[model samples]
Target chain A: MRMAELSRTSGVPVPTIKYYLREGLLPAGQVAPPNQASYDQSHVRRLTLIRALTDVGGMSIATARVVLSVIDAPDRTVRQKLGATIGSLGDIQATGDSGGADRDEEHAQAAKTVDDLLERRGWRVDETSPARAAAAEVLARFDRLGHHRVIAALDGYADAAELTASNDLDVLAGIEDEDELVETALVGTVLGDALLAALRRLAQEHVSGSRYRTPPR
Target chain B: MRMAELSRTSGVPVPTIKYYLREGLLPAGQVAPPNQASYDQSHVRRLTLIRALTDVGGMSIATARVVLSVIDAPDRTVRQKLGATIGSLGDIQATGDSGGADRDEEHAQAAKTVDDLLERRGWRVDETSPARAAAAEVLARFDRLGHHRVIAALDGYADAAELTASNDLDVLAGIEDEDELVETALVGTVLGDALLAALRRLAQEHVSGSRYRTPPR
Candidate 1:
């Protein structure tokens, strides 16, 4: 298909698709004699994934580029690809230096809490995984706010996360194609967060209403 | 304490604190002699909450103001406040008109899926809750991508969300002070999303490793 057809089919603007090509987010199409380029189904799939990463996943182009590279790499195993993709999803500033003794102590405590949770659950995750630090940072912030009760619910959150993660992997394990598997993993990891957060809010409303609201006569 | 002290205590810089004040995110301090003002512990706590909403919650200053106003409005019941706060957290553009027949059909299917999930779970959430549409949008995107497997896991995700939400309300119920309860609710809603996302990633790693990695002899 030509650029116009590609744009129409993918529901992306032609200029935006061109921008993605220029930015190396999408691979260049084959060019013919008058400088006309043609795209195929692979290009369409790539465009869909790009839109998912940027529009739905809320990832910056730079981070999306990194994730795309991980997806494109041929030598890495599926587990390796999953780790790199998840690593790219986190904000680097989250676990950066705090430069204060109080913050350092709080962070140390938070890290210990994460470590304890891992040990209690007997889950095997890398110590240096960005997610470890990211989770700890949230714990530290909760502590700073003097909300120990929220911190106490960590195990419950972890239990729920374990259930959801198992369901996520079960879906991933069903995909046979490597490209589709990685692409689905990326989409599931990113958009799944939005899905779970939205569902949690809905559930909160349900729980709050049941607990507090008066029953209609 | 004064402005400088408030800044020092909250770890938010003076200029940023001033900006929050100018934006009405923080209330005015008590006026003193020579055009000086004095702040109290309340200012420090407000600043902390403001930082959590913006930095940790990834909320815009305008959204933060809306949430803070909901926090300040004294007549609203806790359930009403939670509803408004959760509604405000979603992006307004998500459920807007997609201007396409295909998208409209997909959205209709997604909405039906959400309604079915609510019925299956016996959850009493308002039909108007923004989370319903937000979750539907995610489902629509998944359907567009031809990933039926991800969409198939919706019930699993909802089950996990229910567990976490139950844990969340338990913590909130323990807080006796209405002011602190609402404030903690705001922080928990925002930061708890991050906490859960990070933990889910970690759980994914563990599950992936356990299922895929070859054990050493």
Candidate 2:
């Protein structure tokens, strides 16, 4: 397929496809005799994954690239790929991992909170995973807001996460094609985040209706 | 308190406070004859909320403005405020609520999936809500990927959402002060999204460790 057909089929604009090609996010298509280049089925699938990550997953292009690197790495085990991909997709970028005295103390405290949560759950995950860093940032900020009680939701959130993680991995286990497995793993992490966030808001509406219903006029 | 003290206390920069003031996300402090304005405790609190929303919540200044407007309006009911706040914070922006024929068709199909999920869950949310739109976008993209089967996780996702929403509203109900109530309502919606996403990733690591641990070389 030419770029035009690829764009039409994938619903991505030609210029955006060119941008992805230029950024090396999408592999360059086979060069034709002239200036024209031709894409293929792989291009369609990759473009779709990129669009899902950027558009639905709300990931930055750079994050998408990191996730792609995980997908493209041949020597890494599935576990390594999964960990690398999950760790890279974290949205908490501005966290000062190292700072002055007070900030360092807070990060340590939040890190303890994170470790404690993992320990209590008896979940064997790396102590230094980016999720811990991101969660620590959230916890520290909540403390700054004088709402340390926000941490109370952590246990319930963990329960929910356990259920979701189980379901997500179950689906991953069923995919037979290795390429499809990797693709789903990457797109699923990002798109899955979007799905969960959206569903959570919808559920909030359901709760809001009954719990915070407009007081009778 | 003055702007400097407000900045110091809230950890927001003075220039940001001024920008919020100029943008009307923050109200102007009391004008003094010495060409200086004096802010108060409320300014400190509001600045904190603004920074939290913009920084941690990943909210645009414009969206933060919309959320702040809901918080400041006195006439809105509690449910109205909650609904407005949740509705306004959705990160999905490029949804084809208006688009070409094929796009609209896909949206409609995805909308139906959202509807079926809501109906099955006995949720009373409006069909046209943005959360539904966002979820539909996710579903449609998965469909394009030939993985419409990914919707299998919808029920589990919805279950987790119900649990989280209940927990959120439970906490919201315990807050007695109206100002704090509104503030928590807004920040919780955004920050809660972040918290849940982080927790989900951590849970995934746990799941991965057990389910996809790297095989012994």
Candidate 3:
């Protein structure tokens, strides 16, 4: 299909499709000539995915690109790939591996950064240094919070993400298929937003015991 | 205080602080004269909030700005104002009320967009068409998958977010402090992230015994 057809089918504007191509968020179509190209079902899939990540997941293009790299990277396990993807959430700087006595300089700096932010809030987190303690507390709180059901969903999500990532990796891996990779990234992102949004609404209903609460509750 | 002093106290670098000011993420300090500005405890507090929003909360500058607006907006109930703040996360598209319906177009568009994304992922959400049903399901799963202890924590978290949002709204209400409003937004974003990440981890740990598993015959 031509770009126009692709745009029509995907509900993305033609100019935006061009922009995705330029940003390396979409792969190039087969060159029919110097100025023209052809797209396929893969293009539709990829475009859909791109929209998902950007529109729904709210990931920056650069972050989206990094995630795409993991989906397309061969020689990496699902866990490793996901870790790399999660790494781009822009927090969680590397310390030496978890359970290591020594922390890396980058992680140490990030920890300090996080701590300072916490102390500024005047929230008490038990520790010798408020900043370090705050960062640790943030991690601890993740453990303390309830709604275990969400975690199970996350595990399922992780599993789904893994399966999708592997499936995508197999299709795009080692093929120099930037377009396919972008498509995979887009799908992952869009689905993630949909899933989370859906879950959030459900959770709100059950937890809050109201579909929409009246003001002043 | 000198930049170094501020850096040590805030645990943020002078360069980074400068970056924040330059980016308008933080309000500028009072200029004493040429080439000199004095920052006080307020600046320190502001910087701390800035860090929390950016790093811990993972909000974009634009989103952060919108949040701050709510915090500073005057003459509104805490509940009312916080609802507006939370709505920002949905990336609500601002379409002029074509005199059709207040939020109808926006919600419909959002739901349609959300629905399309979910359909691509093969999740069987009912066609009530708002995508709210689907979202609700996801959240329900979280509730089910979550550990017993986690529900207690989520209760606290929901309380915290609600409480913080309400009180923060009241404190800055009727003042039109865009900075404070943005600060409120930052708090919401960061706190939300912190709460969810914590919940996700706990849920992940207890997925086996929970009702989240496939029902056995």
Q: Mind listing the fnat for each candidate?
A: 0.68, 0.61, 0.05
TM-scores of the candidates, chain A only = 0.89, 0.89, 0.50
Candidate 3's residue-wise lDDT over B146-187, tens digit each? 212222222223332333233333333444645444443334
Clashing pairs in 2: none
DockQ scores for all predicted structures: 0.57, 0.52, 0.10
Give candidate 3 misplaced runs (Cα > 4 Å).
Answer: A13-16, A22-24, A33-35, A73-217, B2-8, B11-36, B92-189, B198-217
Best by DockQ: 1
The DockQ ranking, best first, is: 1, 2, 3
Query: What is the lDDT for B193 in model 3?
Result: 43
What DockQ does predicted model 2 obtain?
0.52
The candidate with the higher TM-score, 2 or 3, is 2
For all predictions, the C-alpha RMSD in Å is 2.8, 3.1, 12.6
Angstrom error of the Cα, residue B198, model 1: value is 1.2
lDDT of 1 by residue, A125-192 (tens): 87678998888888988888898999998999999999989999999888889878888888998889
Query: Which regions in candidate 2 have their CA more than 4 angstroms from the true location?
Result: A95-99, A210-217, B1-9, B13-15, B95-98, B211-217
> Candidate 2 - CAPRI tier?
medium
lDDT (10s digit) by residue, model 2, range B17-72: 77888898999888897878988988876776776776677777888899899988
Candidate 1 lDDT at B5 equals: 74
DockQ, 0 to 1 scale, candidate 3: 0.10
Clashes of each: 0, 0, 28
